[model samples]
Target: MPDRAPQPVDRQLPTDEARDLISLVRDIAQREIAPKAAEEEDAGRFPREVFTLLSESGLLGLPYDSEYGGGDQPYEVYLQVLEELAAARLTVGLGVSVHSLACHALANYGTKEQQAEHLPDMLGGGLLGAYCLSEPASGSDAASLRTKAVRGDGGSWALTGTKAWITHGGIADFCTVLARTGGEGARGITAFLVPGDAEGLSAAAPEKKMGMKGSPTAQVHFDGVRISDDRRIGEEGQGFAIALSALDSGRLGIAACAVGVAQAALDEAVAYATGREQFGRPIADFQGLRFMLADMATRIEAGRALYLTAARLRDAQRPFARQAAMAKLFCTDTAMQVTIDAVQVLGGYGYTADFPVERYMREAKVLQIVEGTNQIQRMVIARHLAGPESR
Candidate 1:
């Protein structure tokens, strides 16, 4: 049987414009992304043209300022669009998220001159971006990153360090880099906007992964990369704060992506169970399979709701860090569970590359470990509720 297209999600958009935006995204995803996702992913080919199309379609900057070539949509609206794209393909969806995170510091903290000079092209000029925070020695403990930036003559700075697990590392047009400039620990770090082709910058070979192979993840090295002082974002010693703020928002994007993956898995499971027969009847007709389907649907709904709630909090300019952590933790766990169940629903066929469920299962594992691990998310939640751990 031919593969079934995923059923449309009944999103609770706040405006007609938001609803229309979701419709446009879904149309693009089904037409442009979903069709080639499996083939290109299997070939380990990055779909650069697809991102260019997204840029031209005004989908790349949905949550930023319209004056700077953004769509001026609220986070609630922006995240639903992410969910739709992710449901079609996680590579495209997560790539967009990382690009947005790369733009966050400059958009929110850069001088007006910097915004005027850079924001338009970065937002809509078909340029890709990468966020550089995690270093070779630092992952969960991002505050301990050791990348260094030293002030030089003529009002410039020289950077030298390696950023690990960077998405779009080698292919990005630009990067938002955090480097230490003062005393030890978080307060000493500062943020800079570095062009990808900076003289001393290069990327290591992409890491071979169990899934999301089409999206390049590699270590980016900065060997005495020099930039003018104008490139520094925010005040000195503010990069850690900036990085944390961006991650609070980035976590929401991950949550939305997780829900999207789970929803896709559930759809696949439902489609397969209803068609594959056992005991001379569709497997979906059995009570056990029916209960499993119901539970899968429920989990998807709950994950969606949790992320949307966090998004709404963000839109309202309220404190959402804790909620964002909760959503990321729950939604990714939901994705992992749903995708595994999807494989079970498909039985033997699911085990083979002939079906997509096995791929989905592999892809779902990484979600639990990215942005922030589920363990880190729990720690963040605990700190918010019970205060920080005793030193």
Candidate 2:
């Protein structure tokens, strides 16, 4: 399909200001992000300057308190912004989500002094951040993470172990890490804020992925990386809780991104069908192709609504974990199906690198696995309904 402007999404905004914010984001996305997306992803280049611009525009911390550098926008509004950015480029949108996840620990649980000291820089000081919770041996079973942090004689601690599948691993300015502070199991883990340039901290090469090549995914090693006691976030045993809380919100971000991808694919399919002719007429005139496009658009709309509902629940300060997981599961599955259908609509051209639909398909696959797999999401939802599984 030929490149075209983003299709308009009718949104329910809480205020005129929110609508204005979306317009600004769309302008930035069109002018700065969408055009270079394919080229940068092909070259496996992360657009650091784009992030700097986002920081400068106050787009990096949309959902946090404005007392810091956050935009103080609600999740409902913030997620729509994410959708706009992701429609332009997943690397940028997903990167913002991960950065918000990294800041969650300190922003929510850190002392006031810590917040005043660190939150501003993270929100808009142009510093990127990463979250470290998963180890090679403990991806889904995060409680079993083996990374250790031993208390020193004074008020410092030294961490040692490897965290896997870290987004922006090599490029982050700081990391919010979960490590063992006591005995085995979840209760022993603690969260810490460690500078990227900490002694003995290093990142291995980025993983060779099928898509999202522009965003690096790699293993980060903490070899006796030391941090002051002041860097500790929340209680010693509260790290797992903090991690789960962050993921609850992070899942909504993924859902928004999934919708963005699906929307882009649908737009491409519609554009291609309306232009590409067969049997002496545009394929869009055929009922079979028209129905496919209709279904694609319908699914995208439902997925967008589903995610927005979850985001709204979160903004209301209510119990939203079940809804968040539901959104993550439903929206990501919709993206996968919709993108695949988009490929079918384009026939042969869709399967090749010549189009972005193929890339959207590859990128959609990962959303099902991250922030708790679809299986895990079902488990979470089931637990919410039927209570925890009996041992």
* Per-candidate TM-score against the hidden true structure: 0.99, 0.98
Give Cα distance to truth, residue 367, candidate 2, Å: 1.0
Clashing residue pairs in candidate 2 are none
Candidate 1 lDDT, 279-382, residue by residue in tens: 99999999988998899899989999999999999999999999999999999999999999999999999888877888778988999998989999999999
Which residue ranges in model 1 land beyond 4 Å of their true spot? 1-4
lDDT of 2 by residue, 135-205 (tens): 89998899999999999979899999999999999999999999999898889999999999999999999
- What lDDT is obtained when candidate 1 is compared to the true structure? 0.92
Report the error of model 2 at residue 55, Å: 0.3
- Clash totals for all candidate models: 0, 0
